[model samples]
Target: MSIENVKNVAVIGAGSMGHQIAMLSALGGFETVLQDINEKALEKAIDMLEQRMNDWVNKGKLSEEQRRLAFQKLRTTTEIKEAAQDADLVIEAVVEKLDVKREVFKLLDQYAPSHTILASNSSSIVNSKIATVTNRPEKILNMHFFFPPLVMDCVEVVKSEETSDESVQIAMDFCKKIGRTGVLLEKEIYGFIANRLLFALSNEAVYLYENGYADFKDIDLIAKKALGHPMGPFELMDLSGIDVGYYANMELYKETQDPKDRPAKCVEEKVKAGELGRKTGKGWYDYRKEVISR
Candidate 1:
């Protein structure tokens, strides 16, 4: 269907990206459902959403009435069938793994109405790969939002070879309704645009630190002071989660069999130690103690 016809939006996976996406949809006046299998995760997501909106209200970025109305338009669910049954658009923000995303899309295809558009928030793995498991490939495309969906204004709207022009237009219109700039890519590519550039910069930073040529903090200092970056590569990784970069790198390595695409040794070690990032309180930096470096 078209943007005007999109009355209900379902966001799968209640983790960082999914919940915030549902908030955006709700703020845009759609009946939004944020769904996850874990009830605790769903509860936590709602709590976090409330806190974030309250913070915005205190900062004068959002109004009390707007926050109340947005909450009124949003709901949480544990059942996939319940979330997708009446959805006009389904945005999957599950884990970055291909198999998991494919399964989510397959189930969405089965439960969502035939007119529902399917989208993925994958950072690297293209929606073309996920669409293989669904019959409505023409309605499936990438609606990749950056980290912290509320703060990020740009979205990468990528269309696979099979994605219909109508789907792309609808996705762009939906992004506008939610206060985001949608940059449409006519063809799919690994990492789309921004992440490809980021991967190259992050890869070199990891290499220098791993090789002992420079301390991670020193590298970050140089990136910020000399390169004019607001956040150093390592700090960005920690904020976004080291596990996310590790998994994205692994996916790239698996596809191209490129040794350079493999995750750095330190990333693997941090992930194994459960030092995922701000969420886990540790990564390259320790968030719990407010330490810049481990």
Candidate 2:
């Protein structure tokens, strides 16, 4: 399959990452489609995207003409089969479950053109499993983008056992076209690349907090001031969520089967208790307004 140019980009899943990828593709001049099973989710995504584009226009980052052009090239649909048929590049970005991903890929594999480049925005699941369901595995590659793809500049391209070098290079070229710095991996490993390093640092931070250590705020301040890090571990985890952090670390442990990579017990307990960070109003810190005597 030749992927010399990806003109039509389809993102399956109207969730956060999927919608963001659609936004970037549309902004990058591709005919973009964002699909989701839930019509309400797709509606919300479109509304949110309009607000963001308006903000960009207000800030002078994008002209009204550019925003109008972007909206023209973008589309949203709930019909998975229809979206896949004409897409030159289909990026599946649903929940990170092997069976779920395979089911979506299997459907796209049957319907999409054989030459269409099949990509995934998966953060945890292995690429090899998703590729095996499709006949043209060489056309399947992992093109993982960071959250807010329009803003973040980093991308990772992974080639699995069945994936071809040409596929990896094509993904690299596409990422550059979308205004990102692309890194290619030789083969599929767990977490691809960025998540592994990020979760490892988070695991240690959780361990520190669990022990007789400083409170979450203090630890965060230390990292921010002393290390000059943009965000502290706890603050970052809160933004990312304890549930997300713990789940990714657990997946890492599953991949390596090593005890060290495992998520901290305290994190497991917190996630189990539904203290899932900022969304829950409590995780590492209490969010209710405290009447402090200043």
110, model 1: CA deviation in Å? Answer: 0.5
Worst 10 residues of 1 by lDDT: 285-294
Model 1 residue 245 CA deviation (Å) reads 1.0
List ranges where model 1 is wrong by over 4 Å.
Answer: 290-294
Per residue, candidate 2 scores C-alpha lDDT tens digits across 192-266 of: 778877777676676777896877678788889998989888877776567766766776677689998777888
Clash list (residue pairs), candidate 2: none
The lDDT of each candidate is: 0.93, 0.82
